[model samples]
Target: MEISDSKKRIEELIEQLNKFAYEYYALDNPSISDKEYDKLYDELTILEKETGYILSYSPTQRVGDGILSQFSKYIHKGRLWSLDKAQSFEEIIEWHNRNVKAVMQYNKENADKLPPLEYVITKKFDGLTLNCTYDNDGIMIKAATRGTGEIGEDITAQAKTIKALPLKVDHKGLFEIHGEAIMTKEAFDAYNEKAEVKLKNLRNGAAGALRNLNLKETAKRNLSAFFYDVGYNEGDPFESYIDMMKFIREKNFPIDDYMKIARDTEDIKNEIEYINSIRADLNYDIDGIVIVINDMRTRAVLGYTIKFPKWAIAYKFEAEETTTELLDVEWNVGRSGRVSPTALLEPVDLGGVTVKRATLNNMDDIKRKNVKIGNRVFVRRSNDVIPEIMGVAEELENAREIIAPSNCPSCGSELMLVGAHYFCENTLSCKPQMVKSIVHFGSREAMNIEGFSEKTAEQLYEKVDLKTLSDLYKLKKEELLNLEKFGDKKAQNLLDAIEKSKECELASFIYALGIPNVGKKTAKDLCKNLKSLEGIKKATYEDLLAIEDIGEIVAKCIIEFFSDEKILRSIDELLAVGVSPSYEETLVNDQSSFMDKTVVVTGTLKNFSRTEIKDKLEALGAKVSGTVSKKTDYVIAGEAAGSKYDKAISLGIKILSEEEFLAMI
Candidate 1:
């Protein structure tokens, strides 16, 4: 193609891609399948490669090909102030009265009629605040984080990934837009499904994604933004806050639809209550509601405090937590024989969930939280995870400190402290340990045996003389029907589930073996390093130690697990019962430059995902390290490569860009 034609084609592709992206991400109405989009994107990429004519606005160029060395600072045109918090209805009323008084004083000075004071209430999004600046041409020029209200890290490239964030506005002439960058619940779930590092909450997911220097990583988070205010405008200012929002909406920016105008303090209270009532149903997380004076002139009259706006206040909803007295600590042994403490609490209702017991984490956490018997503690639940005791809410003078158990609760074996936790050395004989192992073996992430529970394991152990892991496969339907809650259908279903679990992946089966310190990731790593169960049985302690993230302790554990006679006997029995596990064969490119290279990747990369890059390096016979060391041959530094980058520089290791690494591959 001619240069002129290539340029035109690039522009056309950019427009077409942007349109599709906007429709799918912003409008939630995808006109074409992802396959169709990928084909078009591939064509554009080939065209760009041939002509060396990638457009600035091209979807392909949205993510910077290279990671940023450091975040650049950008000064805001106007200062961003935090709102004063109102924790109670009375406090909110006091703020409204203060605003009313200020407005009345202004009216008295002007000798004008007193109009009803109005306040605009918006949901206080639980996310990172972003400030965007548009140039005179109405094109987004820069975006920054809320660093210190006056200056922030320049994240224009990363911010562009937020599809709801308009790159080009209709009325912008050097104006600043302030919004909350958030990860919706749907997006968070979808991202976590495949993400190697799972985010704990939506707030952290959104904040971390924006702060990540890798534009591609930020894009993968599927973050959205809701514009709520204009921090600064170069041209004419709106007479009222509502008019300013209306102007922002007119510019095709994403304005929240839940914004309400409260005419009185009663209306404000009602709005707050309504917001709280529906908070659990919202797609995005919100911590509070922001109430601001509607009229800009009234806000000016109300003025500002040292750190907060006197005209506005944030009504923070109390978190779902309650104080309960710690009755005692129960030591429970798990599949790994790790004995963890559970806080037995005085029953309290927390957000409709009855809380009788909560995780104490470890003995160190109990000490740190100052939790003791007879002391009141705070319990908070996040997502579907078990509720945990946060801290001591009230301390009693006579409260006794929790003492570590000397012996295992399930078995009479002596307890040993391994790091922060206590463990039972007798792994197989302990009833709780064996029961937990059986339950975990049948878990969804492991063997995927449906309808398997701890109670069922207990029943099987007590009634069916289930002494070993392989005993689960030997259960007959007639035998299961004899147990409690086991009807004919339930027994058949359990039998079918056991049959189905027999054909699990090798990695899952390895994880189900319940080796100490061996999780899903470690099990998969073992499979990748050893290939099969036979290879695992034959692997030396040195061979196990050579794998990434496998330390001396894990290596010892793996060797001992494979060497145990009981475990070997159980494996033989399982194999005899038609239990066939499979492992995928990985193709290795031995001739690649990356072969035998000690490579460490840090930060975000545009060309490959976190897992994808690691897999690719491993496929090319490269050993990847979690941390930088002197032995590191190449440090593939991406955007926001913080401490690892600094360490690599200090160690005088070679650093490669994404493009450079791709070339070597």
Candidate 2:
């Protein structure tokens, strides 16, 4: 009722609620029920409204944080490029109304014989949205992050290493394929354990993984990919939208599996809701659902805005909120033994999953969040990535005290202050340390043992004396399936994967070693100079330092690799298990002059029209754009001369009239 009292209540609510969040959302362990948490969340909301106690820290105030990071800038296939973000059912209906109106404006006779504006809706993945370009021969020419839809960094070399990314496609002509780069839930958790940082929420996790400068770490993360569609195909040869996706998939592109064909907008909306309901269980990441008219001709007629295609719209799911009470804060130790303080809370249901605990981040975060025990908090899930403690409602400042731990809870090791991270130097001996090490070794990037996940690997190592990668090769399938959640199917997949990975190259094998500072590139360089894994055993620090990008710290880590008994034995054991490190020479970089160019662009194009213009311009190499520019060498304007026409004339830039476009052709 009073201001101070309201503040106290809000603070108390924050603490109680955040504890529940930390337990349920972040930890995947819930201690309470949904009904109970929601009641408290409601009470906080009602009290705040009635008491006029608008605490800035109110749980209801904090909505979702940033979703995707800044996309790279690039040329759009069309001049108008803006994406649709649907936050509610009403918004979707509004979009639907607009889209239907756009279609109605078309000729009825043209529409009658045609397939009802076929709409294909696929689950929107919550990962790094990437664009891959392929030549007619199916050879991947370039891979890029979706920069502002205009220009993107050339990540061809890095992209090639992702096993899931298709190196060659069956489809011909210039096509822009779009998809998500991700780490599966199984792999992400295991990696987060070893990296000792709470895995970023999935989308963030995947983005962070993709953008990491060290390709070895990226590879080590076992980043998987899923290709959705050929975003653009200049030829218009594919008569049907389904055919285009099929062509993409036939070429072994990773398409989202949770796709369904819907008959109408109603079906689309229902399907979207259904997909959102099952998103938590799905592997990889999904944020919303994308609906696009299946008719390519209709799509062309429909066209698009600067952001989103007119025929395609994304029905983003709303923030599913649940309430919980913060019971206590627990100091958690990661593989790094960073003492991250977690809020242990009462259980709450979010997105159908029972959530009780959530991440309080760190002590600084705890203080900043100001959520203490006895506070009520609400947590929201964004695309199954991670949950955040939005805010505290009806707090109780003095209700209870939650503080950081002075020592590692997993082990008795004293936690020393190291930057924001609390480090415990206990290696291999600490339970979390030992568990994470075993898990990392068996991780997909390393030995890629199938049945081995972070939890399974930890239990196997501790219970069966599974100490190293060698120990894993020795584990019997029967012995593994006997563990928790290890069914016959999973066990077989794991064993089969392990058997298949018995033969590996120097880069992968070196990456599996878990040595700091040595990644895929460093490993490749090490092998390039040494020629064999065994050569690393005999190489001096000076030899390692001679290689570029290999610093003293990395050289020391490599030099110590031979001296460390466990690492040395791990390599030998892998060799014994028939995992040989084969080395290969790296390819020279490709430098086609037409690679970078900038120019105004527009209109319906013929021939490799866009692609050929791109190729030739790229060859003689020029950059083509949708909009005309001031320094435009050639305004390659096709049909429908619009604003660019006036702009070009005013600028006095040379305009390649359709006649001129044909002449150039």
Candidate 3:
């Protein structure tokens, strides 16, 4: 064929092969056979060689033959901010409450009211974060890691190897898109089956592929990606997150089909639960659900914290179970004087964390699970909590039974068996128990005493004989100065911090008390319902159980805690030392039209933002429902209202327009 004809054929073949690759990788729906695709690809390569006319996006250039000497640094067009994390429903609720409060405060102060809070929920992909830059011609120029969020190592060659990623697009815009480069289970298993060195997990598989110097080795992993955000855009500004997502879809970027809009904490919780349930069955891995403010305006208002975006949070799911050999067992005493067995495990990576130790609960748990030294035990980690041994995964021939220690690990005191737990009754002399109690009392979420450390707590426990919780308040500059590394400035600062801790929130005070089964959220719930420390002290079993999130066990624990004479005396002493705990009431207007009503807001509103409307309804004491159901008292319909609006009309629920809602309020 002539050179001109070869060039023309090359262009056509490139387009055809690119389309086939996109269908196979991006859509997971291949229209043509692999044999046919290879035939066309071979022809394109031949034609390009004959004509010396090769496009930058040609499939032939996907994987470079030469290995890279080193990675070059590339500065990102826009900083990629990390999301604040939440592990439980309570944390999500707390984060949601903060968002609601911020929106309410902003609307109350400004003439132009902010919109209601709408969160975009997506999968928090368990992989490396990739930032891909596309030039004005819509051709991908650079791809980098989320190193420091500002600068990153160049991985353009490695990224191009991903068949799902678009090498060129049909647009004329300079932009940067954020995505997660993930290795599907299929890819991981396939690679591991033939390789000499096996991959540890899907996350490491993807991360290792992208960071590899050899392009051929990177291509062997067969990585996939899902773009979520247009981090930097120069063509057209998006009004909302939904708009940006739509733009990404239009540009033929591969995105997960699991995105949803959550209007309230309930919606978020439902989504989180759903994701957690389905994560195991998914071909790719996801560590959590990412909740982002949908509106760009709202995001701008919320802005970014020092390390994370205030408008977004990640509800991390429990880490997957992994098996590790139990090497030994060590007993430790906690703040409650309960001695628990901690299994020393052969170092294993679980959810990117090196887990060297796992909780064995107690002697009962160890016996029940049949966990023994030299046996491979199933370990699972939830959030930042210590990994727990679920059960023995594999029994070894030489495995030995885990024997319970008869004495305390800290003070060598006699251990007393209490139900399922072993306790050290010598709490007055046990150093670990006392030190831990002091540290817990001065924890950031508790009394929040600045400059408080484990070292300082140990020093106080040993040198100053800090025997009780109230003893911390009685600490003086002279006492602190006598300790090692305690200068005049350090001693003064410690004293000031201790003094400042005297005035604390009721919730903090309750949490600092170290009541068994009572966490920060539980303490906050108790403070909110009881209103005063005295009320909590006088609360009956039924009264404690009446509060939300408080179960029978927690109620019993609280009652027992207050019933203790020593605890009661400690409380009295704390009060006598000028410790004051204050509670702030969350007020609502009961007279409002939407008070205690379940209201659903849908579509775009002319006067208010999505979040603004929700916040306004919440302010009026309304429960904003994400879905339209028979329980919905009102459906606030706006322009382009879809299924929820239709469902409301069919259900014969009260419907209100923006004008009607404004008038009603």
Candidate 4:
């Protein structure tokens, strides 16, 4: 075929494949079989290569070239503000009354210059918020997280993997669209079935997929996005949000049909009640309902607060609860060596999903609740995400008392009581603890070992001499192939991931160490303060206490952790095996005002959001803490500073206003 003919054919094929992908992945209805789609895709790819003519909107361009070294921050065209939450009907009424008073006074003053006020209520999706930007050419240039409202992590490549999201739209002239990236129940279960490590919840599933640098893995999650608001657009602005919704719908964007306009507070309340009744029947999870002023004029008049819009509010629903028979209690060991009880039950449908198990917390909780095996228990699911056993509902006459295990199930070691929980002190020998630790070490937020799985950890532990964490670095492809279900591609991929993890950042390496009570945030704080792993190891308890949020207990834990001879040996082994942890150079500042200071930000600030201020503090070589403590050097108080300000004042910590903070910086 001629090049001209090939180009025409490729364009047609690309269009057809895009439609097919949308139908299959987004609409959940496949018009074409996978084989046929693949055939067409292959044909188009070959034609593009042969003719040297590739369409920007081609299906092949959906997957990016390779993994990004690190995600770059993208400044949003406009700030993305959060919504104030209203938990009760009374709070909603109070907000409605305030709106009524404002609109009434405005109409009285201007003699009805503004149109009648109305509200639009839609379900609040419990998923990751994404901002998609389309340039003047109608080409999607970027998709970002709602990082700090003003700036976000660019995930354009990962966003393209969402088949529901349009790679190229018909009309774009600098449009910034807001949407929620969510994973459906079907996709979540399907992924969990094949995945070695299961996703805990749908929210995390969507968030994790987008945050992952690997576009291929992001595609595997089958994320779907529903666009709602036009945050920024150079085109003629819509008179009302409803008109904007119509425009978005015309552009073939995914918008839920559940958006309802309410004329009054009663209408709003009724709509909310209707939403609550059908929430269980919905495909995706929603934590609450968002009520916003529909008219652009009214929204402008109402304006916005520093952090949240005054014209909008979120009404959160109560936690979903159900009762089921507790058949047994299964104890699991965590990376921190803590042994926790999980209640295995007769499957009971709750909030559209069947929950067969729930976290029983600890032995103290079980004993306090008088929980027993074979007893019907009340299980509560928070936001349709985490399941927890609330208490026993019905006690069976034959119910057996739940007894705490005297010995660790994985290592046969003696169980010791630590505060309210039981722990297996044998962290090195316990299979569950060791395996979990290895898995955590290789987790996406930690060492980020690509393709790492619990099954791989189990195989390495049982079959190979993978006794210590250092043994992971010592793994060979040949030995991995000896394990069951191992393939050449899989083994090589894992090995490459292991090698890549050796060059991880200092914060991730510290987090991967699985230190007790040390999370990602704490690890970052430690790294920012200590500057290196060596500094952390050599730091005394007093030195650790100087860091933000590091109290006497946490300080003691850090000192104890580094004091362990085994941990030192493991560190030496890792270093010997060529593992190198790296840290970025400190940011240059005109004045190092906040250097070596521990700062906490409270309430809404005029210049920066909570996250942005924290990042700024960290960038300025200061440790930004979450709480007000005795170690805190300064507290940046914004409008409505609330209890943190009170606590800081009580503790005699220095307080700085937003202007004062800016001046200091």
Top-lDDT candidate index: 3
lDDT of 4 by residue, 580-649 (tens): 9987766746368888889988878998977568778877878777767667899999986655676687
Candidate 4 ranges with C-alpha deviation above 4 Å: 28-36, 320-665
| Cα error, candidate 1, residue 353 (Å) | 10
What's the true lDDT of residue 76 in model 1? 94
- Model 3, poorest ten-residue lDDT window? 642-651
C-alpha-based local distance difference test score of model 3: 0.88
Cα error, residue 148 of model 1, in Å, equals: 1.7
| TM-scores of the models, in the order given | 0.53, 0.42, 0.52, 0.51
Clashing pairs in 1: 67-639
Kindly list the per-residue Cα lDDT of model 2 for residues 145-196, writing each as its tens digit.
Answer: 7766676655544555455565544455777888778778778778766763
- Who wins the TM-score comparison? 1
Better of 3 and 4 by lDDT: 3
| Ranked candidates, highest TM-score first | 1, 3, 4, 2
In candidate 1, stretches whose alpha carbon ends up further than 4 angstroms from where it belongs are: 111-115, 191-197, 214-216, 320-356, 359-665
Give lDDT tens digits, candidate 1, residues 207-240. Answer: 9988887766887898898999999898798988
**What is the Cα-based TM-score of model 4?**
0.51
True-vs-predicted CA distance for residue 217, candidate 1, Å: 4.0
Model 1, residue 507: C-alpha shift (Å): 36
